[model samples]
Target: MTTTQDISQLYPNALWNWFAQICAIPHPSKYEAKLSAHIQQWAAEKGLPVVVDHVGNLIIRKAATAGMENCKTVVIQAHLDMVPQKNADKQHDFVLDAIEPRIDGEWVKANGTTLGADNGIGMASALAILGADDIPHGPLEVLLTVDEEAGMTGAFGLQAGMLNAEILINTDSEQEGEIYMGCAGGVDAEIRLPLSTENTPSGLRQYTLYISGLKGGHSGVNIHLGRGNANKLLARFLAGHANELGIRISDISGGTLRNAIPREAQCRFLIAPEQVTLLNQRIAQYEQILNSELRQTEPALKVRVEESDTQADKVLSLSAQTRWINLLNACPNGVIRMSDDIPGVTETSLNLGVISIENGHGRALCLIRSLIDTGREQVESMLTSLSDIAGAEISLSGCYPGWKPDTSSPVMKIVKDTYESIYHKEPDIMVIHAGLECGLFKKHYPELDMVSIGPTIRFPHGPDEMVNIKTVGQYWELLLAVLARIPQKTA
Candidate 1:
């Protein structure tokens, strides 16, 4: 059978080998027990001390190398769980099937599924360091948290004084040759619109409207990419033509994760037999419009319609359908504000990630992110007002704080100096628009100094996710240099 040894032969064997093993396990967010147990077993085989905290966070401790014991303790952190996303036609089950990894040119990708390189690569790096024989470092603690994608449950539940490390190096950032000092806060907004359903009218034919092929991506990172949101596009079509076409909605669903832009949506509708031709014409026209609008960002955008033989059990009331359409059209999406302090950075943004109809009720999920709490609150308030007017009940949950950048951080200086020394150039230091666990860790460890770094990963939280192979080597080298340079504790 294939093993990690075969995969590790390409390059950066230590890191890639560990990543290969990780991909062999199904560790989707909130369902990581098997992967956690695998990690515990590996630690046991290596004779290392490991513990699982009350919330399932894993911590593994490694002693300092010779002559480096006087340095202050350091923590290397990465999340264990991954966001599960796959292409519409891909048959892999995230809960049961392992991700199939392949090398493409200079990057490592999966077979029409998210490669999980966002944190998987980071996790592999930490594991490689822990298992190394010659790397010089102070006492090292590897923190592997769970359920970071669906929510920051692991980071939130971390008890105070659970870790004694004064310095934390987060291996979760996506870009290489950059140091992330801060990240935005985020909140999940859920809206439920009540609906009433009735028997399908006789002589009405059933048809399914599909919106697919949109280039969905991370809501925070790709919000400004101008990619089409499938839910919004479908909603616009239905809302625009419902009254004229006498459309009756039977069911609607789109998207799965709150952090991923919806890539596909399907809606079943009932209409008079005579309206089928006209509806098809309108769908084709709308598809052309979307193609023209998103051609630059999403050349593969598709909108298709097909007739169904089976009849729908029930259809939403005309009034409820209209309200649902209006609600989707009214909801604000994409970037709302730009940062004045950080040029070219999104200050506030929102993503309409999910929509579904079940049991005569419609639900929509949105993720709102902002660098400032005021900006986040403003968007939340706006959503609340919009939902109220649409007669929908809205609730917020899984709110997490933002990390404020510290320009004068000692750890930042050390990392920057190490990067310049190795590459003969200064590394880009900036704050990200996406949420990071550093924010939650800061709340628990007020005195901890933290920074995030990682290899170049692209299109995370989606099927297009991939990691640059060469950058992994660079990142590993830089991390080791930083570890060796950690300042000795003061007497």
Candidate 2:
């Protein structure tokens, strides 16, 4: 596969060149040390001061350009990690391979995997600014936080006294014309249920039920799109047919990241030799039903039953199977409620994004998001009740508060006015439904003013992810203009 595909030849060579370098490194969440260290060395070569925080975040600072020293210190921020998601047929390893970006029509995408353009462009923009001595800007600081995809470890571990900036421009938002002033808070729920297995009956054949080809996206941003969740689909099939087909599941697993909607799932089970024929017929019938039900959202959904070559002498106990099926059905996996306050905005949502059942244990990882504390709490309350009745243990962690909108904020005003002047039109100023680290930054640096901007990226955190070519240029120009117009610092 072509690694770079001439993206470095795109407009703004300085920015695209940096992005090219980033694509060459593997920087998935929890595995960003290489990329972080690479950037530190790169910064040192540029003669810029670099600071490494205890949480593995990189802070690179540069002095003001000539006359712009009087302007307020501006911080450009972007997360260094990208979500690792790929199609079942794809062989690329996110932690060992370079993202091969290819230009298709007016957008740039990858070869059967996520393009990582959601925040790669943002990081490139910051690096570009830092590399240029001609671009007029105030005292500049580039904050590259690690592990923003799977978790917000860097942001959560950020110390208050580390930053001396008055304004923060987050390059993590997806829309080019949209200015994100606030974002939802989120928490991850990990549900665990102990399992027991029984000896498999003789003359039983092994079969693996597979579900794939569904478009799984960012759990938060695409939850409202009504995409099919592969885990939920697997549960639906097993719950409906386990007893009828006399299936004894040996192993069941689906999804990958807790923050990403699962695109594929599979269940390995044993069935009687005579029932195999009936099971095939039923699978065909069920596949038809699922396709019809999800025709609009999941046209390419595939459900198949394959004979497994691996031998199994054990299967989940009948009681364990029942408990697992019931919990899967009872669990909340999509949008719970839309915001009554903000029209068309999601208020609270849950995604049962990942699950694994094997080795005498079953685990389900879910992510819950909400704009307000109470809304998130409401969903948590439901999960609490579900766990109580399901005889399982549920734990919530990585909880972070939401970034509340500040319409009267001076930084908000500056961004709005600057966009209007540059584009000659009003930009969409709104709060994002997804989680952004701006919320954590607000909690840690209450005195800092923040806003988010980025190029138009589609299907982020999925194999179908892509970035629009034209908007990259537009976003870059707007970012430069915003920096030039940073308000003068005052007491």
Candidate 3:
């Protein structure tokens, strides 16, 4: 029940005000029209030149400071859309309702919903920089891409001649001290399994097997934390007891975004009345086992089996159910390999982010990410091979290239030196496992120098998303320092 007035009291008035305005306007992925218009109007009000690309990407240009006219143009980039996720019991409409922001000690969070701060804060920072008169900078262009969460449509369709900035500063990284020079590329794998149904067996009771309370997070950023996947968990339970308990699944579904770890799942299935006790016992046993395995990361995990009053006249054929469960169990859902080049960084990973069954068919959508093309291809092939054996059709889409790191770049050196000078300590210059727009930008502008940085945000793409208040101030300062020190363009 937090209000805008409460959130507006936070530090850095210009940045928070812009972010608050952004949150007030619902800007979920693929539905960014309103927020896009808001940006255009705001830019116009400031008298800055603005252009909207065909794909809804926004570019607002600011003239150079008096003495900094000789420096190269720097592009401040951020996504315009956000992942819309909320708690199970929260009654919120993402398309029409504004996110309720609250101050939680040292962080800003939404009430039972994902705070759009993943890129909203970054976007707000860019806007603040554009509107500020005190800050010194070279030519500035703010590139706000669209649909970066659910899809990279804007990045994929970015026109080459639209942006003229030689240096791109992507303000989308989550951690404060980490400067991200590169990030993993990704592809989406879709598996479709044809379903076979039969009449519900007489004397069989329909029940719902529910999996919830898992602390699902951004699949790429938190995949290594060993959090449970609800789709996999529910499928595993059904697979383990399908034969013994005579389980006939009628419908199965869970998760939404392909980039977020599934936190909840449920399935309707028919079982003999005699097996009800055994079903409850199995759920209890699995809950204990899962809790023990993921106690540190997913301490609130719950697996519930409840009797449902609704009845189904049809259920999936036993063979179809078996195949479905087996395939879900066989699919990989976590970090596949760690980086040999970057110690402690994930080199290859897969997130079984969404699953749904309808109209005699089921589909599993997964997001595969890797720092190298070979790693991405290997994972894709593995998924296709698994789908082939399970008699399911597989397809891949939205394959984006990874940004190769350049440690010796002038921009990288400038940012690093600026951070060390300000903090009196070395910041971690690392490559992220998450997919970023920098990869796409590199392809369009191969000669452009780029780096990604942002405030500390935790649990993005989920209800627990929050941004650290203190880190925002530090991030703002560092950005200002980096802009002031951008070397003059050479002949």
Best by lDDT: 3
Per-residue accuracy of model 3 over 207-241 as CA lDDT, tens digit each? 88899998899999999888899999988887788
List lDDT for all candidates, in order.
0.91, 0.90, 0.92
Candidate 1 ranges with C-alpha deviation above 4 Å: 1-6
TM-score of 2: 0.98
- At residue 429, give the lDDT of candidate 3: 94
* Per-candidate total of colliding backbone pairs: 0, 0, 0
lDDT of 3 at 307: 86
The 10-residue segment with the lowest total lDDT in model 2: 1-10
Reference-based TM-score, model 3 = 0.99
Task: By lDDT, rank the candidates, best first.
Answer: 3, 1, 2
lDDT of 3 at 456: 98
Which is the better candidate, 2 or 3, if ranked by lDDT? 3
Residue 68 alpha-carbon offset, candidate 2, angstroms: 1.2
lDDT, candidate 2, 344-386, per-residue tens: 7898999998899745678999999999999899998999899
